[model samples]
Target chain A: EDQVTQSPEALRLQEGESSSLNCSYTVSGLRGLFWYRQDPGKGPEFLFTLYSAGEEKEKERLKATLTKKESFLHITAPKPEDSATYLCAVQAGGSGTYKYIFGTGTRLKVLA
Target chain B: NAGVTQTPKFRILKIGQSMTLQCTQDMNHNYMYWYRQDPGMGLKLIYYSVGAGITDKGEVPNGYNVSRSTTEDFPLRLELAAPSQTSVYFCASRRGGTTDTQYFGPGTRLTVL
Candidate 1:
């Protein structure tokens, strides 16, 4: 079975504090890993996509790194505006289908 | 371009009532999907279509139906609404497969009574 597990269900950080969220997965072949940020009462916004192990991508204050078995979303000096639920998803190859298995997500709060 | 638009931002439905949630994208994406998000739960796929005339069930397909008669429109139908169906529904589109970044709508908040 292919599944994703995210840790630290919730986190609170002071403004300017940096942190990292973990997303681990168990799958046969990883085609891609996706990161999304979702605000309250809104749909998720696409963040980054890591295609292979040791791959990394960054946007503004967010950086995403991927490995064979796990992925990390590192927030650098986060601001209150960056507070939101972060979602991680994985797509496995050879499924002969197009579907993504998503993690439960980590709720992040940046207190000002 | 109205990337992906969903109708009825909020809706309240009584048990056993049926409704259709409309979704349309102007990006000419070949893939469209419907997902329901429960509190604290990740978005679960309800249905997806690769292109016109091709629809398939996803992770949670029961109580839902969909049609893709054109590249720009994909609507999700709920027959016999239930309290268990109360959730925020999101419609998304991508140029292709899961590897592609999906653009999502604002989402529709549905409450079942």
Candidate 2:
């Protein structure tokens, strides 16, 4: 069975603090790994998509790195505006079928 | 672009009631999906459509049904709403191919009593 797990169910960091969230997965083949940020009362917003191991992508204060078995989302100098739930999902399928397995997500709060 | 949009941002239903959650996208995405998110849990797929006239069941579909009559509209129907069905529903759309970014709507918070 394919599985995706994220560590540290919740985290609190001081403003300007930097931290990283982990998303580990086990699947037969990894077509892609997705990262999303969701704010309260809103749907998740797309962050990045890593297609293969050793690939990394960054946007503003967020950076995402992917490996064969795990992925990491690093937040640099996080502010209160960056506080939200970070979700990870894996796309594993073939022959045109899509199976998106999502992690429980990590709720982060950056205090000012 | 309107991206993906879902109607009834918040709803309350009594047991045994039925309702339809409307989802529409304007990005010409060939793929549309319905998911339910519980508190502290990840989003669970309810149904998905690859294109018009093609719909399939997903991870959690016991109480949900969907129809995709066009590329822009994919609605999910809940029969006999139950307390366990209370959740925040999200509708998303993705472009063709296997690995495209999915754009989601604001989501609808449903509560069943």
Best candidate, DockQ-wise? 2
Query: For residues B1-113, what per-residue lDDT tens digits would candidate 2 score against the true structure?
Result: 88899999999999999999999999999999999999878999999999999999998899889999999999999999999999999999999786778889999999999
TM-score against truth, every candidate: 0.97, 0.98
Q: How many backbone clashes does candidate 1 have?
A: 0
lDDT of 1 at B55: 93
Q: Where does candidate 2 stray beyond 4 Å?
A: none
| Residue-level lDDT tens digits of model 1 in A29-66 | 88888999999999989999999999999999999999
lDDT of 1: 0.92
* Fnat computed for model 1: 0.72
What's the TM-score of chain A alone for every prediction?
A: 0.96, 0.98
Deviation of model 2 at A82, angstroms: 0.7
Clashing pairs in 2: none
Error of 1 at A19 (Å): 0.9
Q: Which 10 successive residues of model 1 chain A have the least lDDT summed?
A: A91-100
- What Cα-based lDDT does every candidate model obtain? 0.92, 0.94
